[model samples]
Target chain A: MKLISVNDLSLQIEGYFAFKHVAFSLSQNEIIGINGDNGSGKTQLLEAIVSNKTPDSGTIDYTPGVRIGYLPQENPQVIEQSTGKYLEEMRRLSKKLAVRKDQLQAMITYMGLSPYLDTPVNQLSLGLKRQVDFLSAVAGHPNVLVLDEPFAFQSEKTIQRMLDLIIDLKNNNSGIILSATQFDKRIATNFDQLYLLDGDLKNIAAEQKNEPVSLLVFHVSPNSMAITPDVEDFLVSNQDNQIELEVPLKKRQIILNKMVQLNYQFEGMRKIEN
Target chain B: MKIRILLKSYLQLYFQNFLYLTMLFSIIAFELLANHLLEIGNLKKFSLLLIAMFILSLFSTMNLYYNDSRQNKYLKQKINSHWADWSSQLLVAVITNLFSSILIFIFSLLLRDNVLVDFVGILGLFSVGFLGSGIATLFQTQWYDHSTVGQIGVLLFIYLAFSGSVVNILTAVEWLLPPLSKIIMTLQVTSSITKLLPIVGQTLLYAMILFFISGLVYKKNRKNA
Candidate 1:
């Protein structure tokens, strides 16, 4: 069943169109990813879907009595209360939104935030704050989840746990909408559908029908240039000493061998389809 | 049910701020210093306390409004109504200010024995608090983007409410402001119900209108939040 449908959405920020002529639908047990750079209206589009923002022109229809859980990109200005207190208050006020107590408790333990329950949310590290916000949103066993940049400050282990939790929620028939600049292979591959938000919603799969490519990330010493993979590799990112390349499947093993021969440190590699 | 939870949460946060503690202590300290050190009569002391209460309540209410605006986007989504979110915080501000006003009233009574005047002081303080919260809501929600303009407007309103009578040129426009001056005057001059009712009623009516207008403004503007 369609959980929510947005038709011809147009949102303007400061008299400029954030995103216009956007259309999409989310269904039960489906996960949709919105990829966009900064200021591409990803946050604004998500906010409109979650009812935190109003679009200049469009209609967003949700299933009757459908409950929504949203994780905003930023924290509220003043978080004077302890994390535990805030979460408890949110739980107490769930009201029409049902709380998944056991699930939430388990998530807290899994995220390793048990010791910081008494700590003020404002005092928490960026990563921990994001975790707390995520848990608060997940407290309700909502029918739909609207997450904006959920993995921005998360550690790899915590990101994996969150992905596992997302999968679990999907198995329980929850529809999810996630917005991010880019998704790691583990996350992107799991997306049932993907849309690129660049002034409009464009289906990524429909735009590119090519097979998945292998992504190799490694750190090379400045002197090791015996066999560069530039001949058959598309560089995805090069930050710090590490480089991420989208190489053809046929050249994946050759590049790995060349890196091994050149004494380059292998960080990680995976197949990605975008 | 949700509003109650939100109110309780907001109150807990409201009392925990160092500013609130300072404000509370200052109220007591001012009452003490004014009653003990100053060789003024009960009427003058009572007047000073009322003015202090009005200023403190205005700033205190503004402080709460600031805190509420920070989380308003998140809370508005939770409650699914701008009216509920705005009102819950307003109630918190009013309740907190009322507590302090009552405390100051009791402290003054202990220092001096003017029961009738002190009782009228409580009503004046309540009106001050309601009007302050109304103005704070108006600024925080509707005029948030134009904060400088809003701040100037608030300063002008305060100036008019307190010294508008002295500035006789603005006499014709007194009706447009909260009936704070009238309430202060009526509180001091007479102790008769017949005399107090009309002024107090005017103050309450003005406050109610301000609150109603601010609420509508908030509901209208918060859509773009």
Candidate 2:
């Protein structure tokens, strides 16, 4: 079922069209990544979707009862006036918190946000603020999540955790829409549907721009099958006591050395044509 | 639920601009004025002094537009409906002024020397408070941040209202000038209660119309924003 749809929306700003003939739809358990630079109408589109502002000429159609968690583009000063109050207010709005309290607690603990619970949002670093912002949207288990620049200004560890959470939400039948200026290649792999919005919404090719042209297969004895999470991140497939991965040509040597240092007894390393 | 948050925010901002401190000042001024004016032996004098101090305090505080500072656009994201936000903020200020009027009346009950109010006089003041608040709201919405032209005109209007005896000569109708003329005449001549009903009704009518107009203007401004 289509959770939300935007049909031929046009937003004009300062005598120019920020977005023209923009259209897209999001479905359950699917992720649509919007890619755009500054002032490309990404934030306006998200606000229109949430019904915060009316579009110049378009209809953002979504059924009632579909609570959308909108992470706004501008940092609201009200959220910073008091610490932890914003979190509480956000939690109060989420009717699902009564049932998902434990889950939320575990997520907060894992994200290391427990210690800073009382810290003012403005006092926190940009990265921590982003985490707090992300927590506000996810706590409700909202039907649709409209995240604007969710991944910006975050550390690698935090980014990985957010990515994991996004993947988890997708698995739980939640629709996600996000915009970013630049992202790692894994985002392409995680969200297969990507749209490039300059003046209008355009779908980018599904083919990963930096896809590895060569494949490396390593065969290890059944007793020596040991892979750490860091290595598993790049693992494409594993079966029959053999692990296959498409490591970029530039990083293959370092990855091979890291595997050797991990004491994995590999019988052979063969290169396969892409 | 949303109103509670907006009201809390509005009160916090209002106090941040020294509004709470001035409330303390108003109470102290009232006490000193009562003690000093007690010798005059006019009960109405005490009520009028207190009312003047109350108006002074209200006039010192900024008008009740959500834009405390021209740059404070924080409510745009926190609250969704601009009309609700704008109306509720103005209502809080008006209600606070109403409370002030009520408190003054309650204080008047203990006075035996001063005829602080007849039934009609107290009702006149209450109506005046509402009408003043609504006009102030409209004035701030239109010119508070944009320009001071309306505020200068308000000062000129105050001069004219104080000289209502002279101003009423231009009109032949006895009750045409409203609370200003009637209120002045009562202070000068007979303190009759019957002549006050027209002023009360006119003040109320003007207040409602101004409030409705301010709401419409605020809604349009929000849409433009």
Candidate 3:
């Protein structure tokens, strides 16, 4: 079932000519990556999805009871306050889905933030603060997570951990949408689909076998190829003639000797035919 | 369930402000210092200062409430919860009033005179502060953060008109103003009022009325927030 559908949505910032038309459907258990250059309407689109801002003209139909968690680009400050006190009050007021204090604690721990649990949020580094914000948003186990640059300012290890959590949530039937400038290979490999928002919003799907494959031809220098740890595996993978390796631009003799000692084939570089 | 979560979030945000505790301690210290400076025989001056401190406490809480409503994300959610919003406001008012009254009583005790009068004065101060805060919150909910100057003008007008010999005017022209005169009268003659009904009973009645008004305001604001 489609959790959220945005059709012909257009947003215009008042007094400015900036405007964009957006349309998309988010389905259950899907990981959709939104990529775009700076100044594009990526953040605005996310804001519209989160209901933080209403579109100038469009339809955003969200299923009621479909919990939407948004991790904004900027984190708000949570200073030295007793978490239990606030949580207890919320529990008393019955404003939360779950009053299980352990779940909150667990989320804090899962982010590798147990030691700083009692510390003020402002005292934490930018990366750790993002983790806290992410954890807080997902505390109720939201059905759809919208993360804007979730991996920004994060270490590789932390990013991997967050990816694992996202996969876990996806497995549990939660849909994930992320917007970022650069895509990690791990996320690119795991994501179910990709949507690129260029000068104009565009959605790109993975190439299917029956569909015409647009050649994304590029040359790999022999110097770069010589550094390949497993040349045999690289050649075997290139048997489809989709990849072309070029001769090294500089340091060719040294790299050639290394490739020869490793019993690797060093064909003169040529561009791949589409 | 949502109320609990929101309340928890608000409390965290509230405590995080750092200014809250600082203001609380400042009120207590100011009361102590004022008590020390007053002449031992002049209970009226001490009583006036106590009233000022009580007023300060109310204003501080009002400022906090305004800041929270304006800034706290979860408070926006709680504003939608009729029971939680009203109940929390009432609870905060009662606790703040009680704290201010206790501070006044402690200061009076240290001065070592007119204990009964001071106690009665403290009760009156508490009633005024509680009712004033409840009214302010109601007004705030109805009007979006009206100017501080306007609020102060109204409050000063009320004090000038009702706190003195104008009580007779207020009583005679009762229909002109709401039952605010009756509440002011009760506060003005708290000693006799408390004599008629026990202090606890009087406080309970005051609290009940405040809650009732707060409930109406809460419903109105919940629809608006």
Q: For residues B30-107, what per-residue lDDT tens digits would candidate 3 score against the true structure?
A: 656664775543344444544564455445555656556555543343234567756666666666676766675565
* Native-referenced TM-scores of chain A, all candidate models: 0.78, 0.73, 0.72
DockQ of predicted model 3: 0.15
Write one digit per residue (lDDT tens) for candidate 1, span A1-274: 9999999999898889999999999999999999988999999999889876779998999999788989999967456678887776666556545565665667788889889989998899988898888887777777898999999988889999988888888888899999998766557778999899999999985655565678898886776554453432356677787767777687788777877777777788888866
TM-score of 1: 0.80
Better of 1 and 3 by DockQ: 1
Model 3, runs deviating above 4 Å: A8-14, A17-20, A36-48, A54-59, A79-110, A114-122, A181-186, A196-201, A204-274, B1-43, B46-54, B66-71, B74-82, B110-122, B139-225
Alpha-carbon RMSD of each model: 5.6, 8.1, 8.0
Which pairs in model 1 have colliding backbones?
A: none
Better of 2 and 3 by lDDT: 2
User: Candidate 3 DockQ category?
Assistant: incorrect
Residue B79 lDDT (model 3): 32
- Best-fitting candidate, measured by TM-score? 1
Alpha-carbon error at B139 in model 1, in Å?
3.9
Candidate 3 has an lDDT of 0.59
The DockQ-derived docking category for candidate 1 is: acceptable
